[model samples]
Target: MEALLSQFSFLSSQALQDKNFDPTKIDDLMKFFELEAYNSWAAMETDLKKDVDEAEYTMKEAEDHLESVMDSAMDEFRRFEEELDRTLKDELDGLEQVANNAKKMGSSMENAATIATKKYMEAALVSATTTMKSAWKGLNFNSKKIHPS
Candidate 1:
């Protein structure tokens, strides 16, 4: 690069050395400089593209490795989830048997309490519906006004 720049500088100095340099000759010199600049730029751009392609290939290989790791992690997670589900089912069955035994022992008070709790929850839910609707409307209005598109 330094050698090419030095050669270009020498050429420019030689071009300027002529005492009675013709305008047409000067124009030709300018065209030569322009061509050289364009060719140099094209070569640099090609080298940059090659570097970019190599970088992209390296990134793709990394992505493939990441995907393989994620697949292995997912398989381990699935096995863990299956084991957890089996344990939960066994616990649930034991709880169900305990509840049946309690019911057989005439635990009618628990059933009544459960019904009352359900009724209270339903009433609270109904009462909050209008407030929730109004809040949602206000949020939507503010969001639309603040963010156009």
Candidate 2:
């Protein structure tokens, strides 16, 4: 029994020394995601403001160019419509980029979790094996003394 206790203490201390659990990686990942999200949101907001400003400028130019001429007004209107279409396309592309970045972040987090779980399982298995080995040795010693052959 004393041998078993000493063996268990030694093995447990060794397992502690070889621990693989690291929490800093998780904190770093979260910080990265937070910064990425803020940057994306800021870019989208800037693009939206610029697009609105451009549309307003075009409208002002259209008003100044018109002088009771229907054909000229129609041409300016067409130009404004094309500019609006381009702005919408730009916004859509930005949204798509943001979605892709979010997906990448999620996958990175999942991979981190998987790695941590694997490390934990490996440590548990090592401890279990060590305990079994110690118990088997103790049992064998006692059995030999009892048999004396």
Cα-based lDDT at residue 106, candidate 2 = 91
**lDDT value, residue 56 of candidate 1:** 100
CA lDDT, every model vs. true structure: 0.83, 0.79
Q: What lDDT is reached at residue 81 by model 1? A: 100
Candidate 1 segments exceeding 4 Å error = 1-19, 93-149
Compared with the true structure, what per-residue lDDT tens digits does model 2 show for residues 21-81? 3545445555765776788899999999999999999988887666446778788999999
Worst 10 residues of 1 by lDDT: 139-148
TM-score to native of every candidate shown: 0.48, 0.43
Query: Candidate 2: minimum summed lDDT over ten consecutive residues — where?
Result: 21-30
In Å, residue 22's CA in model 1 sits off its true spot by 3.4
lDDT score, candidate 1, position 59: 99
Candidate topping TM-score: 1
RMSD of each: 33.0, 55.9
C-alpha RMSD between model 2 and the true structure: 55.9
Distance from true location, Cα of 82 in model 2, Å: 1.6
